[model samples]
Target: MPINSSLASLSDMAFGTAFVIYLLAMILSVVFYVKAAGEKPEGAQKFIGMTQSLVWLGIIVHLVSVVTRGLATHRFPFGNLYEYIAMITLFAMVVAAIFMQRREFKPLWPWVLVPVLSLLFLGGKNLYADAAPVVPALQSAWLPIHVSVVASGASIGLISGVASLLYLLRRWQPEGKEKGFFGKLAKPLPGAKRLDLVAYRTAIITVPVFGLGIILGAIWAESAWGRPWNWDPKETFSLITWFLYAAYLHARATSGWQNTKAAWINIVALAAMTFNLFFINLVTSGLHSYAGLN
Candidate 1:
């Protein structure tokens, strides 16, 4: 059955609007962080509160947009690149919000989130197609579960990468001295060890989910395409990314590779994941060719 074309477009427009609002919230967050760095904690807290409220508002709007799109399309909406980016960004926001609630890592929100939110909007604008409807191959019930889990794991990996970047920027500076763009920025950032631990925790929690996503993906592939392993570019890169994190986990558990070195590994793993997600989709062709811009 064909989807409701008008409704699908409306949902996309709504999501775009929400994404713009999210970008604005990120700007406010940056302002707050800058002010806080200058010792104006009161004003910073107010702005941060306002930013948080706006983030929640954006979340609600995005949720409505995605749910409506799924309903209108009458499919899982993970069939194309635009929808996948939307879902991935949403998952990242959720993870960030959760971490902010528990950790003192709120300072990293703007630098980490704004780029992702912007990319999601760009992807939606350039990659989204009309709800052309899904084929029989995508009608399986496992589609949503598999895609959602994988997206969640990717979100955690992204946040871990951001934290690792911040750690490196801080660690490279001389003790009690700040230099360079990142070094100047690091004055207000959390301690290097703290940032590394945050990255470590995020990666550790995500490893199991990442493993599950790959396993479930293999199961789905076997069911849908009659093969459990295809050695596609995306698949190969994803396995590499998985192994990178697995090594990190093992090093943390055995060799005392804490702090800067662990952070560097996180950055490397994230780079691989980013290559798999963006470069592989654009420059390479494979079973994952559905990721092309429309």
Candidate 2:
């Protein structure tokens, strides 16, 4: 089906507006965190409330943008790299926002908002694509199913990994009463032990979902290409990412590899997923090339 140009334009407008809102929310979150560093608890609460409201508002607008694109195209609206990135960003934001519902995630708003804002900016500014029908390969029902699961896992992993990184930073620089910049940053973050546990549990929950996405992709591949494991660049890198996470989890049960080392492995897994998302799609050639819109 052809795109409705007017609807598509409206969708783009919403997307751009959402990006600005997310950027504003990111700034507000940082201000909120900074205020939290001081002794003014009431003032800090004011900023935090404002930040949370902005984030939720941006999320609602973004959701409408995604849905409007789907309406414009009468499909999932993720045929090309632009839509793919947009979906990933949207799903990530949704998950991050849900986690933020818990007050424990309050201090992590800025950390969460930065990536979401960056992704929305790049997607809107540089990777914008008009609403279009899916490519032949993407016409199957499997791609959206596979992609939603995989993207959700990626988002969960990314945010949890960021928490792990913060865990390390906090460990390297303990919380103190000083009003310095680093001190302020460290004060709000949960301890390394707490962060590590959160990251681990998140990984545990996400890995199976990601694995199921891969399984579905293989099923789709068998139908599309008459084979399930052709070792495409994207597939291969995805497997590598899966294995890294597997090893990280297994190592967690080991005697000596359960602390910072496991956290480091999760970081590497996060990097591998990033490379798969961008490098494999953009720089490499394979069956998934259509996904890059190349």
Candidate 3:
């Protein structure tokens, strides 16, 4: 078999296997948390051990899938939206796993995965790509540099959003007085205060990385498109996301915008970011239409 073809097949198999493993981790996590709530006699530690191990295993498999795809394409693997989705999600999973190692963030470990899994599912099903030579538009040396950093920044920002969302949903469950299925689930989540800390810290790290990414893109654009900024739909929306995040940080520093309000702003920031990724890249035609969907 051809090397690229063999690698592509292996990538597909790895992607599918990672998805199944993540699903199993989610199930195991649910069981672990339920038992941790003391309703069952079985040890929760064992389940958590299995869940964490499976999570790392899934990450390794997904990493293999991404690396293989890049090898198959004989270029950077981030040329299309399909590839972007898978790789960015891999970054998110890595961040979530690191955060999960913290005791304050441990209980909500599996919850952090719910979004990553969903994105992976979407990527694997709807945005999958076959290995091929990319268009000249994607031939720039910056493909691996600019786009990779941008994707990493975006992935880290996604984790911040997940933490913020969890904070909002479980902000009221501190005393465990709340009664409901979700409430029980929320019981293990870090308190609003802790979640806020993580969200803020994570966002802070992302800001500089994302900003640098935009700047790098500008540099690439200057070389590729004869101008640094074209006000393209993708660029415009990216600016919007950056400013929204800026406003989120600003609001946090200002009066009365701390807690829930700031959380909402971060959520909206994430929403804008997601919209920029899908809608701008897929629905609208522009310079960033490298999604390869058509």
The lDDT of each candidate is 0.79, 0.79, 0.85
Worst 10 residues of 2 by lDDT: 172-181
Name the top TM-score candidate. 3
* Per-candidate TM-score against the hidden true structure: 0.92, 0.93, 0.94
Please give, for residues 214-270, the per-residue lDDT of candidate 2 as tens digits.
898899889999999899999999988988887777877689775788888888898
Off by over 4 Å in 3: 1-3, 38-42
Strongest candidate by lDDT: 3
Ordered by TM-score, highest first, the candidates read: 3, 2, 1
Candidate 1: segments with Cα more than 4 A from true spot:
39-42, 174-176, 292-294
Candidate 2 deviant stretches above 4 angstroms: 39-42, 177-181
Q: Positional deviation of 73 in candidate 3, in angstroms?
A: 1.3
Which model is ahead, 1 or 2, in terms of TM-score?
A: 2
Model 1 earns a TM-score of 0.92
**How many backbone collisions does model 2 have?**
0
